[model samples]
Target: MTGQSLLLIDGFNLLSRAHFATSYNRTDDQLKNSKGMYTNALRVFYQKIFNLIRDHRITHLSVVWDVKRDETARRKKYPFYKATRFELPEPLIHQYETCKAASDAIGIHQISLSPYEADDLMGALSKKWSGGDCYIYSNDHDLFQLLSETTSQIIAGKQGEYVYSLSHFQADYGIAPEQWVDVKALLGDSSDNIPGCPGIGEKSALPLIQHYGSLERIYENIEQLEPGLSRLKKKLIQGKETALLSRELSQITCDIAELDPLLMDDLKVSIRKDVLGEWLEQMELKIRIDSYGA
Candidate 1:
């Protein structure tokens, strides 16, 4: 916790949040610049970045993006993965690309690898920067598995920003961070279209993972489970394959080989005030360029 802290952002996640935050009660035209391009999300995106850097005293920063949805490894493995989620709005899509360009103009490291997600990139980077205090800026609960003594997750909550640490995970879930995938495997995530164990949810998943430690262990001792939990045991037995697949989908890849060569020094924040001011002016964003204090 004493070393320099690195802030790894899930780019699209933050952009989507910014879009909703600024788009409320506003039409597409109202959110657009004079050139007919969207600026609301882009404005809020930079504002959040500036705020996060100032608030966290972030020494190193990186913005991670997801490749095309169809090109993702998860979608290739399970065609139905994330199929339920709606497509990004046209305005948001425009702003997303602008945000990436703006991030680069300001000298922030932007990462996007084929077949992997922002979550995976953040996981890989967090693992690579394990020597220091690394913070994953995202609202995705699935990233909880990456929590450790040196890594935490920053979530933008309704009240304010909440930082979830290893201790917080332990206190809230009463299970190891590594066991989160197992819990999700049993409980399922409707948002992501991950069909977890049938007839199983938090009520059953939590105790099963807390008691057995893992999905495999639960199955190893399946027959020995108490008679009072016979129904839950039966559900696990029937959903074994699904649960295994769900675990695979829920788990974040923390060792992307391409990210291995990326050193912490490469991510050190070195914003070019001149470039940022010019980019903001070009985008017609109303953000206070002076607040960045690059």
Candidate 2:
């Protein structure tokens, strides 16, 4: 907590937010550049990144991206994981490429690994940078499991940005941050297609986790559950396998071997002024370089 602060960005998370924010009601043609490509996401993405850097006084930065869904280990374990998501729009895909190029041009370190999601990379990096303060920028509730004394999550909401700390999580959930995976394991995540215990929702899941501490322990002491929870115990018994599988899918991988060699010094933010200016001109964005302290 005393060392330099690191900002870990959930790359596609921010891009999708920016894209939807600017293109909600507008047509593709309305946000295109002179070269006939969409600039809406790119402009907003750049602006948001710089704003966060300044707002947080971030000394280190890393934007993490997910590998293809089919290629990820989670999808391999559960083929239906995130299967309901639609393909990205053509305009948004173009902007994603442009944003990556711009990130490289500006010297923002970008990290990605095949067969691993961005969440895993962020978790690994947060663990690796444990000596420093790490702020994970994402709205994904799945990342809640990564919260700790030194690591926090930054959720960008409509009204403003809010930091979710470990204490805030403990107060809200009435359990340790690591226990969040068990909560998800009991209730499941519809967005990710993780099927938790059947017939159990947040109402049943929260209290069970708060009392039992974890999915494993809940099963270990299933027979000891109060008579008032007979129906809950039945559901847990029926969905034991599903709940265990869901926990595996819900938990973030924190000890990725590939990320072991990366050092904090590698993530030090050093924007390339000339490259950024040229890239912005090519993209026809009107953002002033001087505003970023170039």
The TM-score obtained by model 1 is 0.95
Question: Where is model 1 poorest over a 10-residue stretch in terms of lDDT?
Answer: 285-294
Tens digits of per-residue lDDT for model 1 on 56-153? 78888999999999999999989999999998899899888777777777898899999998889888888888447888899999999999998999
Q: What clash count goes with each model?
A: 0, 0
Across residues 62-113, which tens digit of lDDT does each residue of candidate 2 receive? 9999888999999987799999889998988888888887788789899999
TM-scores, all models, native as reference: 0.95, 0.96
Clashing pairs in 1: none
